[model samples]
Target: MARTARGFAALALAVALFGSSGCGYNTLVSEREAVESAWGEVQNQLQRRNDLVPNLVETVRGFAAQEENVLREVTEARSRVGGAATPSEAIEASNQLSNALSRLLVVVERYPELRSNQNFLRLQDELAGTENRLGVARKRYNDAVQRYNTTARRFPTNLVARVFGFEARDYFEAPESARGVPQVDFQRRP
Candidate 1:
Protein backbone atom coordinates (compact mmCIF):
# COMPACT_ATOMS: atom_id res chain seq x y z
CA MET A 1 0.00 0.00 0.00
CA ALA A 2 1.08 3.61 -0.64
CA ARG A 3 2.12 5.74 2.36
CA THR A 4 -1.02 7.84 2.14
CA ALA A 5 -3.22 4.75 1.88
CA ARG A 6 -1.46 3.18 4.92
CA GLY A 7 -2.00 6.36 6.89
CA PHE A 8 -5.71 6.27 6.14
CA ALA A 9 -5.79 2.59 7.08
CA ALA A 10 -4.29 3.42 10.47
CA LEU A 11 -6.81 6.21 11.01
CA ALA A 12 -9.62 3.91 10.00
CA LEU A 13 -8.37 1.29 12.42
CA ALA A 14 -8.14 3.85 15.20
CA VAL A 15 -11.66 5.10 14.64
CA ALA A 16 -13.06 1.63 14.35
CA LEU A 17 -11.41 0.56 17.59
CA PHE A 18 -12.33 3.62 19.68
CA GLY A 19 -15.32 5.14 17.96
CA SER A 20 -17.98 2.86 19.40
CA SER A 21 -16.88 3.60 22.99
CA GLY A 22 -16.90 7.40 22.45
CA CYS A 23 -13.82 7.76 24.63
CA GLY A 24 -11.87 9.83 22.13
CA TYR A 25 -14.56 12.47 21.71
CA ASN A 26 -15.29 12.60 25.43
CA THR A 27 -11.61 12.88 26.33
CA LEU A 28 -11.22 15.78 23.93
CA VAL A 29 -14.20 17.56 25.50
CA SER A 30 -12.86 17.09 29.03
CA GLU A 31 -9.35 18.19 28.14
CA ARG A 32 -10.59 21.26 26.32
CA GLU A 33 -12.56 22.29 29.41
CA ALA A 34 -9.50 21.77 31.60
CA VAL A 35 -7.52 24.04 29.30
CA GLU A 36 -10.24 26.69 29.38
CA SER A 37 -10.45 26.53 33.17
CA ALA A 38 -6.69 26.86 33.48
CA TRP A 39 -6.74 29.83 31.11
CA GLY A 40 -9.42 31.51 33.26
CA GLU A 41 -7.23 31.11 36.34
CA VAL A 42 -4.36 32.75 34.51
CA GLN A 43 -6.62 35.64 33.59
CA ASN A 44 -7.84 35.94 37.16
CA GLN A 45 -4.27 36.19 38.46
CA LEU A 46 -3.37 38.64 35.72
CA GLN A 47 -6.31 40.82 36.76
CA ARG A 48 -5.23 40.69 40.39
CA ARG A 49 -1.83 41.97 39.34
CA ASN A 50 -3.51 44.58 37.16
CA ASP A 51 -5.64 45.88 40.03
CA LEU A 52 -2.51 46.29 42.15
CA VAL A 53 -0.60 48.34 39.57
CA PRO A 54 -2.23 51.74 40.03
CA ASN A 55 -1.58 51.67 43.74
CA LEU A 56 2.01 50.65 43.16
CA VAL A 57 2.39 53.39 40.58
CA GLU A 58 0.83 56.00 42.86
CA THR A 59 2.96 55.10 45.85
CA VAL A 60 6.09 55.20 43.75
CA ARG A 61 4.94 58.42 42.10
CA GLY A 62 4.56 60.26 45.39
CA PHE A 63 8.25 59.96 46.17
CA ALA A 64 9.67 59.70 42.67
CA ALA A 65 7.77 62.15 40.52
CA GLN A 66 10.92 62.79 38.57
CA GLU A 67 10.83 59.18 37.41
CA GLU A 68 8.07 59.87 34.88
CA ASN A 69 9.48 57.84 32.00
CA VAL A 70 9.62 54.55 33.90
CA LEU A 71 6.21 55.22 35.44
CA ARG A 72 4.66 55.90 32.03
CA GLU A 73 6.11 52.71 30.60
CA VAL A 74 4.58 50.69 33.42
CA THR A 75 1.17 52.34 32.93
CA GLU A 76 1.23 51.86 29.18
CA ALA A 77 2.20 48.22 29.56
CA ARG A 78 -0.64 47.65 32.02
CA SER A 79 -3.06 49.29 29.59
CA ARG A 80 -1.88 46.95 26.86
CA VAL A 81 -2.57 43.99 29.13
CA GLY A 82 -6.06 45.30 29.77
CA GLY A 83 -6.79 45.82 26.09
CA ALA A 84 -5.29 42.57 24.79
CA ALA A 85 -7.88 40.75 22.67
CA THR A 86 -6.22 37.33 22.54
CA PRO A 87 -4.08 35.03 24.64
CA SER A 88 -1.01 35.70 22.50
CA GLU A 89 -1.51 39.45 22.77
CA ALA A 90 -2.07 39.21 26.50
CA ILE A 91 1.10 37.14 26.92
CA GLU A 92 3.11 39.74 25.01
CA ALA A 93 1.57 42.63 26.98
CA SER A 94 2.01 40.85 30.27
CA ASN A 95 5.70 40.30 29.46
CA GLN A 96 6.00 44.01 28.68
CA LEU A 97 4.32 44.87 31.99
CA SER A 98 6.74 42.60 33.82
CA ASN A 99 9.71 44.30 32.19
CA ALA A 100 8.31 47.76 32.84
CA LEU A 101 7.67 46.90 36.47
CA SER A 102 11.25 45.65 36.77
CA ARG A 103 12.46 49.01 35.51
CA LEU A 104 10.19 50.73 38.01
CA LEU A 105 11.69 48.69 40.82
CA VAL A 106 15.18 49.62 39.70
CA VAL A 107 14.08 53.23 40.00
CA VAL A 108 12.99 52.55 43.58
CA GLU A 109 16.53 51.47 44.40
CA ARG A 110 17.81 55.02 43.79
CA TYR A 111 15.63 56.61 46.47
CA PRO A 112 16.35 55.61 50.06
CA GLU A 113 13.18 57.19 51.50
CA LEU A 114 10.92 55.49 48.96
CA ARG A 115 12.21 52.13 50.07
CA SER A 116 11.37 52.91 53.69
CA ASN A 117 7.85 54.25 53.05
CA GLN A 118 5.18 52.06 54.63
CA ASN A 119 2.73 52.30 51.72
CA PHE A 120 5.38 51.40 49.17
CA LEU A 121 6.46 48.45 51.30
CA ARG A 122 2.90 47.18 51.64
CA LEU A 123 2.23 47.56 47.91
CA GLN A 124 5.50 45.85 47.15
CA ASP A 125 4.52 42.95 49.37
CA GLU A 126 1.15 42.66 47.71
CA LEU A 127 2.71 42.81 44.27
CA ALA A 128 5.07 39.99 45.22
CA GLY A 129 2.17 37.82 46.33
CA THR A 130 0.29 38.55 43.11
CA GLU A 131 3.34 37.62 41.02
CA ASN A 132 3.61 34.30 42.81
CA ARG A 133 -0.02 33.54 42.11
CA LEU A 134 0.37 34.57 38.49
CA GLY A 135 3.32 32.25 38.13
CA VAL A 136 1.34 29.32 39.51
CA ALA A 137 -1.60 30.09 37.25
CA ARG A 138 0.61 30.32 34.20
CA LYS A 139 2.15 26.95 35.00
CA ARG A 140 -1.26 25.38 35.34
CA TYR A 141 -2.39 26.97 32.10
CA ASN A 142 0.64 25.66 30.24
CA ASP A 143 0.21 22.22 31.73
CA ALA A 144 -3.41 22.11 30.68
CA VAL A 145 -2.46 23.27 27.22
CA GLN A 146 0.06 20.47 27.02
CA ARG A 147 -2.55 17.88 27.90
CA TYR A 148 -5.15 19.22 25.49
CA ASN A 149 -2.71 19.67 22.66
CA THR A 150 -1.36 16.19 23.23
CA THR A 151 -4.80 14.69 23.12
CA ALA A 152 -5.89 16.74 20.14
CA ARG A 153 -2.87 15.88 18.09
CA ARG A 154 -2.45 12.22 19.02
CA PHE A 155 -3.27 9.48 16.56
CA PRO A 156 -6.97 8.57 16.68
CA THR A 157 -7.78 11.64 18.80
CA ASN A 158 -6.54 13.83 15.96
CA LEU A 159 -9.28 12.44 13.79
CA VAL A 160 -11.90 13.19 16.41
CA ALA A 161 -10.43 16.63 17.05
CA ARG A 162 -10.62 17.48 13.39
CA VAL A 163 -14.14 16.13 13.17
CA PHE A 164 -15.27 18.24 16.10
CA GLY A 165 -13.35 21.39 15.06
CA PHE A 166 -11.03 21.33 18.04
CA GLU A 167 -7.98 23.26 16.99
CA ALA A 168 -4.65 23.51 18.81
CA ARG A 169 -4.35 26.29 21.36
CA ASP A 170 -1.45 28.76 21.53
CA TYR A 171 0.78 28.50 24.58
CA PHE A 172 1.48 31.60 26.66
CA GLU A 173 5.20 31.92 26.19
CA ALA A 174 7.56 34.86 26.49
CA PRO A 175 8.89 36.23 23.25
CA GLU A 176 12.50 35.29 22.46
CA SER A 177 13.67 38.86 22.97
CA ALA A 178 11.89 39.07 26.29
CA ARG A 179 13.29 35.75 27.49
CA GLY A 180 16.74 37.19 28.07
CA VAL A 181 17.66 38.87 31.34
CA PRO A 182 17.01 42.59 31.02
CA GLN A 183 20.17 44.64 31.04
CA VAL A 184 19.89 47.26 33.76
CA ASP A 185 22.59 49.85 34.35
CA PHE A 186 22.61 50.65 38.06
CA GLN A 187 24.73 53.68 37.22
CA ARG A 188 22.08 55.15 34.94
CA ARG A 189 19.90 57.82 36.58
CA PRO A 190 16.16 57.33 36.54
Candidate 2:
Protein backbone atom coordinates (compact mmCIF):
# COMPACT_ATOMS: atom_id res chain seq x y z
CA MET A 1 0.00 0.00 0.00
CA ALA A 2 2.82 2.46 0.87
CA ARG A 3 4.52 1.69 -2.46
CA THR A 4 1.33 2.63 -4.34
CA ALA A 5 1.05 5.92 -2.39
CA ARG A 6 4.67 6.86 -3.21
CA GLY A 7 4.08 6.13 -6.92
CA PHE A 8 0.94 8.37 -6.95
CA ALA A 9 2.89 11.27 -5.32
CA ALA A 10 5.61 10.98 -7.95
CA LEU A 11 3.02 11.09 -10.75
CA ALA A 12 1.39 14.22 -9.32
CA LEU A 13 4.77 15.97 -9.08
CA ALA A 14 5.60 15.16 -12.68
CA VAL A 15 2.22 16.47 -13.87
CA ALA A 16 2.66 19.74 -11.97
CA LEU A 17 6.10 20.33 -13.44
CA PHE A 18 4.89 19.60 -16.93
CA GLY A 19 1.99 22.01 -16.59
CA SER A 20 4.22 24.83 -15.30
CA SER A 21 6.68 24.41 -18.17
CA GLY A 22 3.88 24.55 -20.70
CA CYS A 23 2.57 27.92 -19.49
CA GLY A 24 5.75 29.73 -20.57
CA TYR A 25 5.66 28.08 -23.99
CA ASN A 26 2.03 29.09 -24.41
CA THR A 27 2.72 32.73 -23.56
CA LEU A 28 5.54 32.90 -26.08
CA VAL A 29 3.34 31.52 -28.81
CA SER A 30 0.58 33.99 -27.98
CA GLU A 31 2.95 36.96 -28.15
CA ARG A 32 4.34 35.92 -31.50
CA GLU A 33 0.81 35.55 -32.86
CA ALA A 34 -0.12 39.04 -31.71
CA VAL A 35 2.83 40.50 -33.62
CA GLU A 36 1.94 38.60 -36.79
CA SER A 37 -1.72 39.68 -36.66
CA ALA A 38 -0.73 43.31 -36.23
CA TRP A 39 1.64 43.05 -39.17
CA GLY A 40 -1.26 41.87 -41.35
CA GLU A 41 -3.25 45.00 -40.47
CA VAL A 42 -0.30 47.17 -41.47
CA GLN A 43 0.02 45.38 -44.79
CA ASN A 44 -3.69 45.77 -45.50
CA GLN A 45 -3.50 49.51 -44.89
CA LEU A 46 -0.50 49.77 -47.21
CA GLN A 47 -2.40 47.89 -49.88
CA ARG A 48 -5.24 50.37 -49.49
CA ARG A 49 -2.77 53.20 -50.20
CA ASN A 50 -1.48 51.37 -53.27
CA ASP A 51 -5.02 50.96 -54.58
CA LEU A 52 -5.60 54.73 -54.38
CA VAL A 53 -2.50 55.71 -56.35
CA PRO A 54 -3.70 55.12 -59.91
CA ASN A 55 -6.74 57.33 -59.47
CA LEU A 56 -4.63 59.99 -57.82
CA VAL A 57 -2.10 59.89 -60.66
CA GLU A 58 -4.81 60.13 -63.31
CA THR A 59 -6.47 63.06 -61.61
CA VAL A 60 -3.20 64.98 -61.47
CA ARG A 61 -2.25 64.04 -65.03
CA GLY A 62 -5.26 65.83 -66.45
CA PHE A 63 -4.22 69.15 -64.91
CA ALA A 64 -0.48 69.08 -65.69
CA ALA A 65 0.85 67.02 -68.52
CA GLN A 66 4.41 68.31 -68.00
CA GLU A 67 4.88 67.08 -64.41
CA GLU A 68 6.55 63.85 -65.46
CA ASN A 69 9.25 63.92 -62.75
CA VAL A 70 6.78 63.87 -59.86
CA LEU A 71 4.72 61.16 -61.51
CA ARG A 72 7.79 59.00 -62.12
CA GLU A 73 8.89 59.40 -58.50
CA VAL A 74 5.50 58.20 -57.31
CA THR A 75 5.67 55.24 -59.65
CA GLU A 76 9.16 54.23 -58.55
CA ALA A 77 8.23 54.59 -54.92
CA ARG A 78 5.23 52.38 -55.47
CA SER A 79 7.43 49.78 -57.08
CA ARG A 80 9.85 49.85 -54.16
CA VAL A 81 7.04 49.35 -51.69
CA GLY A 82 5.74 46.48 -53.79
CA GLY A 83 9.15 44.82 -53.84
CA ALA A 84 10.12 45.32 -50.20
CA ALA A 85 11.65 42.16 -48.71
CA THR A 86 11.05 42.52 -44.98
CA PRO A 87 8.52 44.20 -42.73
CA SER A 88 11.03 46.85 -41.68
CA GLU A 89 12.07 47.39 -45.27
CA ALA A 90 8.45 47.59 -46.34
CA ILE A 91 7.65 50.22 -43.75
CA GLU A 92 10.62 52.33 -44.79
CA ALA A 93 9.83 52.03 -48.44
CA SER A 94 6.19 52.79 -47.86
CA ASN A 95 7.07 55.94 -45.94
CA GLN A 96 9.34 57.07 -48.76
CA LEU A 97 6.59 56.46 -51.26
CA SER A 98 4.13 58.37 -49.11
CA ASN A 99 6.55 61.29 -48.89
CA ALA A 100 6.95 61.41 -52.65
CA LEU A 101 3.20 61.24 -53.08
CA SER A 102 2.79 64.11 -50.63
CA ARG A 103 5.20 66.18 -52.69
CA LEU A 104 3.15 65.41 -55.79
CA LEU A 105 0.02 66.54 -54.01
CA VAL A 106 1.71 69.83 -53.13
CA VAL A 107 2.36 70.31 -56.83
CA VAL A 108 -1.38 70.00 -57.32
CA GLU A 109 -1.79 73.11 -55.18
CA ARG A 110 -0.15 75.08 -57.96
CA TYR A 111 -2.95 74.25 -60.39
CA PRO A 112 -6.24 75.80 -59.37
CA GLU A 113 -8.11 73.63 -61.88
CA LEU A 114 -6.61 70.42 -60.43
CA ARG A 115 -7.38 71.49 -56.88
CA SER A 116 -10.99 72.24 -57.79
CA ASN A 117 -11.61 69.10 -59.85
CA GLN A 118 -14.13 66.83 -58.20
CA ASN A 119 -12.18 63.71 -59.11
CA PHE A 120 -9.01 65.14 -57.65
CA LEU A 121 -10.87 66.20 -54.50
CA ARG A 122 -12.33 62.75 -54.11
CA LEU A 123 -9.01 61.01 -54.57
CA GLN A 124 -7.40 63.39 -52.14
CA ASP A 125 -10.03 62.60 -49.53
CA GLU A 126 -9.57 58.90 -50.05
CA LEU A 127 -5.81 59.16 -49.78
CA ALA A 128 -6.16 61.16 -46.57
CA GLY A 129 -8.41 58.50 -45.11
CA THR A 130 -5.97 55.77 -46.10
CA GLU A 131 -3.11 57.65 -44.47
CA ASN A 132 -5.07 57.87 -41.24
CA ARG A 133 -5.72 54.14 -41.36
CA LEU A 134 -2.07 53.43 -42.09
CA GLY A 135 -1.05 55.49 -39.07
CA VAL A 136 -3.37 53.52 -36.83
CA ALA A 137 -2.14 50.25 -38.28
CA ARG A 138 1.49 51.22 -37.75
CA LYS A 139 0.81 52.14 -34.15
CA ARG A 140 -0.91 48.87 -33.53
CA TYR A 141 1.95 46.95 -35.11
CA ASN A 142 4.50 48.74 -33.00
CA ASP A 143 2.51 48.04 -29.88
CA ALA A 144 2.31 44.37 -30.74
CA VAL A 145 6.00 44.19 -31.50
CA GLN A 146 6.78 45.85 -28.21
CA ARG A 147 4.75 43.29 -26.36
CA TYR A 148 6.30 40.39 -28.22
CA ASN A 149 9.82 41.67 -27.83
CA THR A 150 9.28 42.18 -24.14
CA THR A 151 8.01 38.67 -23.74
CA ALA A 152 10.80 37.17 -25.83
CA ARG A 153 13.34 38.86 -23.59
CA ARG A 154 11.71 38.32 -20.22
CA PHE A 155 13.13 35.70 -17.83
CA PRO A 156 10.87 32.62 -17.87
CA THR A 157 9.27 33.25 -21.25
CA ASN A 158 12.66 34.04 -22.74
CA LEU A 159 13.71 30.47 -22.07
CA VAL A 160 10.65 29.14 -23.90
CA ALA A 161 10.98 31.66 -26.70
CA ARG A 162 14.56 30.57 -27.32
CA VAL A 163 13.63 26.93 -27.29
CA PHE A 164 10.79 27.53 -29.75
CA GLY A 165 12.83 29.76 -32.11
CA PHE A 166 10.63 32.77 -31.53
CA GLU A 167 12.72 35.86 -32.17
CA ALA A 168 12.19 39.54 -31.46
CA ARG A 169 10.26 41.58 -34.00
CA ASP A 170 11.23 44.98 -35.33
CA TYR A 171 8.99 47.97 -34.79
CA PHE A 172 7.54 49.87 -37.73
CA GLU A 173 9.31 53.17 -37.58
CA ALA A 174 9.18 56.10 -40.04
CA PRO A 175 12.42 57.58 -41.25
CA GLU A 176 13.55 60.93 -39.92
CA SER A 177 12.92 62.55 -43.30
CA ALA A 178 9.35 61.27 -43.21
CA ARG A 179 8.71 62.20 -39.59
CA GLY A 180 7.09 65.49 -40.58
CA VAL A 181 5.07 66.82 -43.52
CA PRO A 182 7.25 66.87 -46.61
CA GLN A 183 8.36 70.24 -47.84
CA VAL A 184 7.15 71.05 -51.35
CA ASP A 185 8.38 73.93 -53.48
CA PHE A 186 6.13 74.91 -56.37
CA GLN A 187 7.74 78.10 -57.62
CA ARG A 188 7.44 78.25 -61.40
CA ARG A 189 10.52 78.63 -63.58
CA PRO A 190 10.91 82.16 -65.01
Candidate 3:
Protein backbone atom coordinates (compact mmCIF):
# COMPACT_ATOMS: atom_id res chain seq x y z
CA MET A 1 0.00 0.00 0.00
CA ALA A 2 2.91 2.41 0.80
CA ARG A 3 4.49 1.69 -2.60
CA THR A 4 1.19 2.44 -4.39
CA ALA A 5 0.81 5.74 -2.46
CA ARG A 6 4.34 6.80 -3.44
CA GLY A 7 3.53 6.08 -7.13
CA PHE A 8 0.38 8.24 -6.88
CA ALA A 9 2.32 11.14 -5.38
CA ALA A 10 4.87 10.96 -8.18
CA LEU A 11 2.09 11.05 -10.75
CA ALA A 12 0.54 14.11 -9.08
CA LEU A 13 3.87 15.94 -9.09
CA ALA A 14 4.32 15.21 -12.78
CA VAL A 15 0.87 16.56 -13.55
CA ALA A 16 1.56 19.75 -11.57
CA LEU A 17 4.80 20.31 -13.44
CA PHE A 18 3.04 19.85 -16.77
CA GLY A 19 0.32 22.30 -15.74
CA SER A 20 2.89 24.95 -14.78
CA SER A 21 4.67 24.56 -18.10
CA GLY A 22 1.37 24.95 -19.89
CA CYS A 23 0.83 28.34 -18.24
CA GLY A 24 4.21 29.45 -19.43
CA TYR A 25 3.32 28.40 -22.96
CA ASN A 26 0.13 30.41 -22.79
CA THR A 27 1.96 33.56 -21.67
CA LEU A 28 4.49 33.18 -24.47
CA VAL A 29 1.78 32.80 -27.07
CA SER A 30 -0.08 35.86 -25.79
CA GLU A 31 3.04 38.01 -25.87
CA ARG A 32 3.88 36.86 -29.39
CA GLU A 33 0.38 37.78 -30.52
CA ALA A 34 0.81 41.27 -29.13
CA VAL A 35 4.02 41.68 -31.09
CA GLU A 36 2.37 40.43 -34.27
CA SER A 37 -0.54 42.85 -33.91
CA ALA A 38 1.81 45.74 -33.41
CA TRP A 39 3.77 44.73 -36.46
CA GLY A 40 0.56 44.70 -38.45
CA GLU A 41 -0.08 48.30 -37.48
CA VAL A 42 3.39 49.26 -38.58
CA GLN A 43 2.83 47.59 -41.95
CA ASN A 44 -0.48 49.38 -42.36
CA GLN A 45 1.11 52.74 -41.78
CA LEU A 46 3.81 51.94 -44.31
CA GLN A 47 1.21 50.97 -46.87
CA ARG A 48 -0.58 54.24 -46.21
CA ARG A 49 2.62 56.14 -46.96
CA ASN A 50 3.14 54.10 -50.13
CA ASP A 51 -0.37 54.86 -51.28
CA LEU A 52 0.11 58.60 -50.75
CA VAL A 53 3.37 58.85 -52.71
CA PRO A 54 2.04 58.84 -56.27
CA ASN A 55 -0.48 61.58 -55.57
CA LEU A 56 2.20 63.66 -53.87
CA VAL A 57 4.57 63.18 -56.78
CA GLU A 58 1.95 64.18 -59.30
CA THR A 59 0.99 67.28 -57.33
CA VAL A 60 4.60 68.40 -57.10
CA ARG A 61 5.18 67.72 -60.76
CA GLY A 62 2.15 69.78 -61.84
CA PHE A 63 3.58 73.03 -60.47
CA ALA A 64 7.30 72.41 -60.56
CA ALA A 65 8.03 71.15 -64.05
CA GLN A 66 11.77 71.87 -63.78
CA GLU A 67 12.16 69.98 -60.46
CA GLU A 68 13.47 66.85 -62.14
CA ASN A 69 16.07 66.13 -59.43
CA VAL A 70 13.54 66.23 -56.59
CA LEU A 71 11.08 64.09 -58.52
CA ARG A 72 13.75 61.52 -59.34
CA GLU A 73 14.84 61.32 -55.72
CA VAL A 74 11.27 60.76 -54.57
CA THR A 75 10.75 58.12 -57.24
CA GLU A 76 13.93 56.28 -56.30
CA ALA A 77 13.05 56.34 -52.62
CA ARG A 78 9.57 55.02 -53.37
CA SER A 79 11.01 52.20 -55.40
CA ARG A 80 13.35 51.26 -52.56
CA VAL A 81 10.45 51.24 -50.11
CA GLY A 82 8.38 49.05 -52.42
CA GLY A 83 11.20 46.55 -52.80
CA ALA A 84 11.93 46.20 -49.10
CA ALA A 85 11.43 42.61 -47.90
CA THR A 86 11.71 42.82 -44.11
CA PRO A 87 10.24 45.12 -41.51
CA SER A 88 13.60 46.59 -40.69
CA GLU A 89 14.35 47.13 -44.35
CA ALA A 90 10.96 48.73 -44.86
CA ILE A 91 11.53 51.18 -42.00
CA GLU A 92 14.89 52.15 -43.41
CA ALA A 93 13.47 52.60 -46.88
CA SER A 94 10.55 54.63 -45.53
CA ASN A 95 12.94 56.91 -43.71
CA GLN A 96 14.83 57.45 -46.92
CA LEU A 97 11.62 58.33 -48.70
CA SER A 98 10.62 60.68 -45.91
CA ASN A 99 13.91 62.51 -46.16
CA ALA A 100 13.62 62.80 -49.90
CA LEU A 101 10.08 64.11 -49.62
CA SER A 102 11.11 66.60 -46.98
CA ARG A 103 13.76 67.94 -49.32
CA LEU A 104 11.21 68.14 -52.10
CA LEU A 105 8.78 70.03 -49.88
CA VAL A 106 11.47 72.49 -48.93
CA VAL A 107 11.99 73.03 -52.62
CA VAL A 108 8.27 73.61 -52.98
CA GLU A 109 8.44 76.28 -50.30
CA ARG A 110 10.61 78.35 -52.63
CA TYR A 111 7.75 78.41 -55.10
CA PRO A 112 5.14 80.37 -53.13
CA GLU A 113 2.80 79.85 -56.05
CA LEU A 114 3.07 76.08 -55.75
CA ARG A 115 2.52 76.23 -51.99
CA SER A 116 -0.72 78.14 -52.56
CA ASN A 117 -2.05 75.52 -54.95
CA GLN A 118 -4.96 73.66 -53.33
CA ASN A 119 -4.04 70.21 -54.58
CA PHE A 120 -0.38 70.49 -53.58
CA LEU A 121 -1.28 71.75 -50.11
CA ARG A 122 -3.81 68.97 -49.60
CA LEU A 123 -1.31 66.28 -50.58
CA GLN A 124 1.28 67.81 -48.28
CA ASP A 125 -1.17 67.82 -45.39
CA GLU A 126 -2.08 64.19 -45.98
CA LEU A 127 1.56 63.18 -46.17
CA ALA A 128 2.24 65.01 -42.90
CA GLY A 129 -0.63 63.20 -41.22
CA THR A 130 0.59 59.86 -42.53
CA GLU A 131 4.07 60.59 -41.17
CA ASN A 132 2.61 61.21 -37.74
CA ARG A 133 0.67 57.96 -37.89
CA LEU A 134 3.77 56.08 -38.99
CA GLY A 135 5.69 57.44 -36.05
CA VAL A 136 2.98 56.31 -33.63
CA ALA A 137 2.83 52.88 -35.21
CA ARG A 138 6.58 52.43 -34.94
CA LYS A 139 6.52 53.36 -31.28
CA ARG A 140 3.77 50.87 -30.60
CA TYR A 141 5.61 48.16 -32.46
CA ASN A 142 8.77 48.80 -30.49
CA ASP A 143 6.87 48.68 -27.21
CA ALA A 144 5.27 45.37 -28.13
CA VAL A 145 8.61 43.92 -29.24
CA GLN A 146 10.15 44.95 -25.94
CA ARG A 147 7.39 43.23 -24.00
CA TYR A 148 7.61 40.03 -26.03
CA ASN A 149 11.39 39.92 -25.87
CA THR A 150 11.34 40.50 -22.11
CA THR A 151 8.80 37.75 -21.58
CA ALA A 152 10.59 35.35 -23.89
CA ARG A 153 13.85 35.88 -22.03
CA ARG A 154 12.36 35.45 -18.58
CA PHE A 155 13.10 32.26 -16.63
CA PRO A 156 9.98 30.11 -17.01
CA THR A 157 8.86 31.63 -20.31
CA ASN A 158 12.34 31.27 -21.75
CA LEU A 159 11.97 27.52 -21.83
CA VAL A 160 8.68 27.74 -23.70
CA ALA A 161 10.04 30.40 -26.09
CA ARG A 162 12.99 28.22 -26.89
CA VAL A 163 10.75 25.28 -27.53
CA PHE A 164 8.46 27.35 -29.74
CA GLY A 165 11.28 29.09 -31.64
CA PHE A 166 10.35 32.66 -30.67
CA GLU A 167 13.10 35.02 -31.72
CA ALA A 168 13.84 38.60 -30.81
CA ARG A 169 12.39 41.26 -33.13
CA ASP A 170 14.35 44.25 -34.44
CA TYR A 171 13.40 47.79 -33.58
CA PHE A 172 12.23 50.27 -36.22
CA GLU A 173 15.10 52.71 -36.40
CA ALA A 174 15.44 55.60 -38.85
CA PRO A 175 18.23 55.29 -41.36
CA GLU A 176 21.56 57.02 -40.73
CA SER A 177 21.12 59.17 -43.81
CA ALA A 178 17.80 60.41 -42.44
CA ARG A 179 19.08 61.30 -39.00
CA GLY A 180 18.25 64.98 -39.56
CA VAL A 181 16.18 67.13 -41.85
CA PRO A 182 17.59 66.76 -45.33
CA GLN A 183 19.30 69.78 -46.83
CA VAL A 184 17.23 71.37 -49.58
CA ASP A 185 18.82 73.46 -52.27
CA PHE A 186 16.21 75.73 -53.78
CA GLN A 187 18.60 77.86 -55.82
CA ARG A 188 16.87 78.34 -59.12
CA ARG A 189 18.73 80.14 -61.90
CA PRO A 190 17.82 83.82 -62.06
In lDDT terms, which candidate is top?
1
**Candidate 2 on 121-148: residue-level lDDT in tens?**
8888899899999999999999989988
Model 2 misplacement above 4 A: 1-21, 181-190
Which of candidates 2 and 3 is the stronger one according to lDDT?
2
Model 1, span 1-190: residue lDDT tens: 6999999999998768677537888999999999999989998988999999999999999999999999999999999999998888989899999988988988998887888799998988999999899989999999999999999999777878898999999888866766687665544554
**Which rank order by lDDT, best down to worst?**
1, 2, 3
lDDT of each: 0.88, 0.83, 0.83
A best-first ranking of the candidates according to their TM-score comes to 1, 2, 3
Instruction: Pick the winner on TM-score between candidates 2 and 3.
Output: 2
TM-score of each: 0.85, 0.83, 0.81
Query: Which candidate would rank higher by TM-score, 1 or 2?
Result: 1
Model 1: residues with Cα > 4 Å off, grouped in runs: 1-21, 176-190
* Cα displacement (Å) at residue 169, model 2: 0.5
Q: Residue 33 error for model 3, in Å? A: 1.8
